[model samples]
Target: MKLINTEEAVGHVLCHDLTQIIKDVKKVTVFKKGHIVKEEDIPVLLSIGKDHLYIWEKQEGMLHENEAAEILYGICKGKYIRPSDVREGKIELIAKEDGLLKIDVEKLHMINSLGEMMIATRHSNFPVKKGDVLAGTRIIPLVIEKKKMDEAVKLAENKALIEIMPFKKKKAGIVTTGNEVFYGRIKDAFGPVIRKKLEEYDVEILGQKILNDDPEAISQAIRNFISEGAELIICTGGMSVDPDDTTPTAIGNVGARIVSYGAPVLPGAMFLLAYCNDEIPILGLPGCVMYAKRTIFDLVLPRIMADDKITQEDLASLGHGGLCLSCNICTFPNCGFGK
Candidate 1:
């Protein structure tokens, strides 16, 4: 990685991802206060102003400004973020400059959903200078006063910085394991319910399986899915504390590490998460998740589709005001439940 000055940073125009690389980007550098490090292939070391920053090495991948900010958030937690995880947020095209495009998030309504309202912004002309504030976001608590949340939203809009959303093309795999569901005593209502939930995110159903209560068999199916390149896995039924409820055990038997066996939130208290690896995520969902108006699964599915790694602390933070009342108008689009 190499560090370059303002002139070097703006020499080459950035691609659709809004980033370029410096020839010799360094790991770290210290710039004088109010220094203008032009935007180039190098990433920003410190963004002190709308136009001043320190540049670092440029990485490959298409990413929006807010998405990059989210990766930086993972870095703060000592987590690794792949370039593939970085994606475009809300944006729209206005005109073409030379070979570059002039885009604006607010004007284009480029956001994927309201949850991304916190990271949207109108990036200025292409070939932005070093330390230029291409886009900015602030991660506040999930539960804040509605009035306060409204204020923040207004603030971001006034500054032309809104939450950007990633292109959410999600493919789902379902694992149905239960003696009752497997034996067909009762119709498998869970699959349709999960499918409807997946529809909220427009996720496609990649595959589905119905298995017995045997933990070993269930585990093998999950492993098979990993081999099939399933990015998100959801196992329904058999998620209770009873001996017959072996969904959690089945997930563990497959050697996938569970992020949280139980969450602090209601309805989905028995929700289970297992990282088949950092790339493939498996979820053992409870029966409550299938029927509840807004369970923990409802709260989490969006994050997963957005390619976020749910952590223990992140789950624990949902305890306050997690339950959802079936609203008459279903104004969830304006509400801040999952944001």
Candidate 2:
């Protein structure tokens, strides 16, 4: 930073904020840091009694905050994600379409640990809607070494640190198991909840089959759905390990690879995820989904809808923020649950 005559400050960046005070009126910042001095602002500077102002001196191998922020944004910009206009040395990444957000947590950490820069973002593996601010990148100082920005670019390795996988169009068949629903012992309360959740994505309901707690019948229904071109199959009820629960057995009997039969989450610990023919997904949901505001289903649905395969390690990581507080007014996706 250097001091120069206010008249000679034109085309230079302000080193700090300049406040203008008026008695019995208002005290406001007339000019903010990083603001480029304009030719017409000379009169205002004279009126404000700022004959000499501090300004950042452009030098070799140094970058202004706005320039550094662009590098940070380049590290994060990816498919279905766009950058907000740089403002005050900050640029935010906004989602251009509704989809699942994936982040390279390790890459993001390395850039942040470099000091003098930052990238803040929403939780990874969660659903985000169009216009949601996925991440924000900025430079901490008014000016930074060009080498620092170059290091961040290298950390990206020519790939964006964040991305959005658009949800794929899928036709799903519903398998409602349990003697209670099949035999008319109780009203099928799961259908409404299941339909509402499924419709949130690009999934079309081929149809729903209400079956008894018989593994054979359940497996047959699943096969029938797969034969009818269902890309996804959801089996509600009969997921517990009880003698009467048979959905897990039915899914396994269908020659499907079970990614996981349970998660480290409450209200949906018995949730099951499987893939048939090594492509189609088959989900076995526990009973809590019918009443609970949010469950493991909400956490994993985005990944399935986007066709992003879920591995055992992916499910295991959910344990850290898996347990929901079960608040009365549940604000899922916006809460700590499954974050």
Candidate 3:
């Protein structure tokens, strides 16, 4: 460590005390290019008790150690932007004297509302530094009034549907139980219908189990499937208050915590969710899920498969545009059902 003044020192150094005063210190060098940043590296940086740090010219514009750490965490878990390809499009580019870039796309598919963006080079082989201009994107246009776009350049922000991709590849577990389908009676149409819905999301079934109207056995099946490593568990059959309807009861019996019992949604009002210890999610879908064009499942499934934990507020937000009437052509991305 090189100490230039009484205030602070640079290079890697550890201190057990915090009363130390460090002033006018420009930068610290804890890491360099080619070093992968992890969440564990945060406290080490913060131990210096400094809010910001600078890197060499070659290391500029790289996500801050903490921010890069978070992005890497998501990427390692397969919950991230698809790195297979970079999708780009031309928009009207407007650069301000302050060096902020405004981007406009046909539509933004976002999990959280756009607040800010981390711009970096899309190339996997090329190196990016702290001040290096990656792709410039700002959220100001999306949140501000119409005048905002007028003052900014129109540029498309090439975005990857991180949540949708995993959903498309996810192997699912389906549990269906109902006296109507268990006995030699009406066809077991729900399974095929639900399968079709999963097809739209490109979800594949890893396993399917059928049970009588027994909550205990149905719950056990859910546990069994989860133990077998089902990322998504979908339970169908009984989602209503009918005496025989037991799917909801079964899901709760399996020691899973419910997100909501009944939604303010039509068609699929009896939707239920439970998070296992590992955060693997289980859903008790209402019968309307099997037939309705737009149900609570349609609203919640995408977010859930994206690994987003739905909250009461998130569900409440959907009430503004909860109903989805079947149409000749579904304009989903444009529709605000789950936006």
Candidate 4:
């Protein structure tokens, strides 16, 4: 690219976008890339502080900013992920469907550290809707060395660094257990809360089972749901250490392998996660889930819906940002309850 003074750029082509900023009013691209500079545009370019402009020039071993952005997008784009139009040397990766967003943080960091380029994305392992911006790739300069962009792409190996895992399993069953709610002593509040939360996802509510604090009965209910083609089973209550709390025991008795009996998160310390035949997930949510605006349940439900298996190590890693502040105006999932 060649640089020329704005007054002498009448017949030249702009290699990059020239932005105009009117604070509190507007910030727009007055002169776009590839725009043929006309005599009438000189005063406008000067007003926007563009005393000099870069003109596009074909080079043997260099890439334009827009071209470099496509390579960066290729490094991060995966299935169910699509790219936005290249604008001002930037391209955004948008979700093709509502799903779980998985980011290779290590590879992303290494690419960003290469200098002159960057890929900014949302927190990994979180839920994202269709049309959500998963990430954006931008080149710092109007032009960059082809070798530098090649180094960025090579760091991703053969696989894309960013991915969107669409929700696979959808059939869900809820089991509410507690003597007080089972009998006429108290109303069943847990079932409603669990149901409302499940409504956020695209899943079929197989049914809700209200049972007493009997481990055998709870286990049988779980088995029944699985036999009825339940993809996910939720067991609420009976998660405490008290003698009457048998939710955890009932889940284990169902022949399901436990993933993590507890997590390092607040408002959900007694949370239990187990899998039956390594496919069907049975979650034993603690008392906090019945009332807390955001808990460990909110953190992991997206992974379960997307069929992204959560390991014990996944639960153990939530210690860093697990505490919920319980703000007056709750903006969960957006806030860091279990980030």
The candidate that achieves the highest TM-score relative to the unseen native structure = 4
Which prediction has more favorable TM-score, 2 or 3? 2
- Residue ranges of candidate 3 with Cα displaced over 4 Å: 1-168
Q: Estimate candidate 2's alpha-carbon lDDT, on a 0 to 1 scale.
A: 0.91
Q: In candidate 3, how many Å is residue 222 off?
A: 0.8
User: lDDT per prediction?
Assistant: 0.56, 0.91, 0.53, 0.92
Better of 3 and 4 by lDDT: 4
Candidate 2 lDDT over residue span 276-316, tens digit each: 99899899999999999889889888999999999988889
My TM-score estimates for the predictions, one after another, are 0.52, 0.90, 0.53, 0.96
Best by lDDT: 4
**Ten residues in sequence with the least summed lDDT for candidate 1:** 75-84
lDDT of 1 by residue, 192-217 (tens): 88888887565678788999899998
Residue 196 CA displacement from its true place in model 1, Å: 1.5
lDDT of 4 by residue, 1-339 (tens): 998888999888899888888989998888888999999999998988889888989899999999999999999999998899888999999999988999999999999999999999999999999999999999998899999988887899989999999987489889999999999699888888888888888889899999999999999999999999999999998999999999999999999999999999998999999999999999999999978888899999999998999999999999989899999999877887777
Error of 3 at 185 (Å): 0.8
**Models sorted by lDDT, best on top:** 4, 2, 1, 3
